[model samples]
Target: MPSRSLTDPPRIAFAGTPEFAARALEALIGFDCDIPLVLTQPDRPAGRGMKLTPSPVKACALAHGLTVDQPDTLKTPELRAPLVEAAPDLLVVVAYGMLLPRAVLDIPRLGCINIHASLLPRWRGAAPIQRAIEAGDARTGITLMQMDIGLDTGPMLAEHVVDITDIDTTATLHDRLAEAGARLLIDTLPDLLAGRVTPRAQPDHGACYAAKIGKTEAALDFRRSASELGRRLRAFDPFPGGLMSVDGTPIKLWRAEVLAEPGAPGLISRVDDQGVVIGCGAGSLCITELQKAGGRRLPVAEFLRGHALAAGQQAQLPG
Candidate 1:
């Protein structure tokens, strides 16, 4: 590797789409890294109007005055040709949504580096942040790995861990990990450019795939223990929140805590200012916040004002 002065920054091509991806781009740009081009997912229909909306990464790239590309697919020769022409020294990929073929991966001189949301060899697929909390993992973190053809089976260059708390939600953890990943990437860039960073292969043991969260998974199953239900409620809080049916209307569980006692699952165990205490298979859950179909999130007291949830009544949740 040729040694260049700090003033001569490496030409980097950043590929990503979501807010998490934007954070890394922001860090790279903050350090004035040679971001010659930014590639993100194509704009798609969003919101009630279904108007095409640019991804967070695209918006950030444009804001930074960086050249942007919204390629629908990189497998095409036309799309991959321009990226190769750019002659980027390194490619940085975050949540870009589309898989990169080997042809595209081999374009950059230093190959591609990805800021994955989880520690490699564990939670290697999509939805790692949510899955970690849903499974009640003790800790989760970020891994800067070399991109490969395999599903996040890349060699890791760096990693940082963050402990998961009982009250932590997916939103909170995602933000923290994104910031951590950005700092780690920026700190490691100098070494990466100097060819001092060595990639380490991940172990096959303790590997788990975090399948993307589906709408059906949002349906709360009260038959599960309170602790398990509580984790789901927290894991899915902001998106596809743990849901139940009340008079056939889908009710979202926004906030909840587990209780120690046993009762009939889905039974209304208690009701208080905080919220309603619903029984699970082995324990109970005190729902502090909730929302009904076509309704806004509200505190338990506020929700009770508009709806009736009496003690002893059953709350049926989908399995």
Candidate 2:
């Protein structure tokens, strides 16, 4: 909705939270886009100190001297005033966390564009990075789409596909996708602003919600196949993690590999330098990295030095 010609640079407003969003903002700044204001969620208590922490987006905005706004909700007219006054031509929203009401969406002339972690219509909600890996998806990518009222249901503008390796964890995949999204947005901005890009409706099929991840789902279930368990172990790393209880001592699994051999479920078939091999329903898993409740993740050899886990021991699994 900028008054200037379509080829001219339009005033872009940005909204986002977290490190993922911060990366995109950094890209926009690097591109020398005319960003007048940044919108992010309010500061929240974080870390063991429970001190108020600025969202990554806000921190980046302040560092770059960009005007920042934090509102509890944009549903009210008063809360949406700053955005209205900014009069941005287009709003680029990443993982802003808060939903934009209809009023806020209509403020910009060209509406808003979102940078999503997964290819739209696939993982369409929070925690897409973890869900894709947990679901054993072979490939995942970033989707830049127009924003609508529905959850990630808007038409897609473009996408950058990223191959999912067998060993990728949510933490690892998240970094890759975050950078990819930044690059994709930069590459597509000119065409999008110039009206050279067309929005294509997402397919009706292949739709699924990526529900937010919770700590409760971190426990490792030996009843599942080794491959499934292995994927989960990698997916949950640096988060709730793959939990297992041995001799009543809870441990978090960081890295693992599936094996063809089988033994009684929850049974430990081997424990040596390779890993702590544990049996599952279909096969076995070699757990290479582990952490204690309050300790750091360490290689199996280092973990063994502090804990006494023998091959005959059984890993406690949920009944």
Whole-model lDDT values for every prediction: 0.89, 0.91
Candidate 1 error regions (>4 Å): 1-7
Runs of candidate 2 exceeding 4 Å displacement? 1-8
Please report how far candidate 2 places residue 310 from its true position, in Å: 0.9
Q: Report the lDDT of model 1 for residue 236.
A: 86
Among all windows of ten consecutive residues in candidate 2, which has the lowest summed lDDT?
1-10
Q: Please, what are the lDDT tens digits per residue for candidate 1 over residues 1-319?
A: 3556757877999999999999999999987567878999999899879999999999999998999988889988898866877778899999999889999999999999999988878998989999999999999999999999988999999999989987999999999999999999999998988999999999979899999989888888788999998998888867889888866667888899788988888988788787799889889999999888788999999999998888888778653
Residue lDDT tens for model 2, 128-240 = 99889989999999999999999999999999999999989888898999999999999999899889999999999999999998988888889899999988887887787
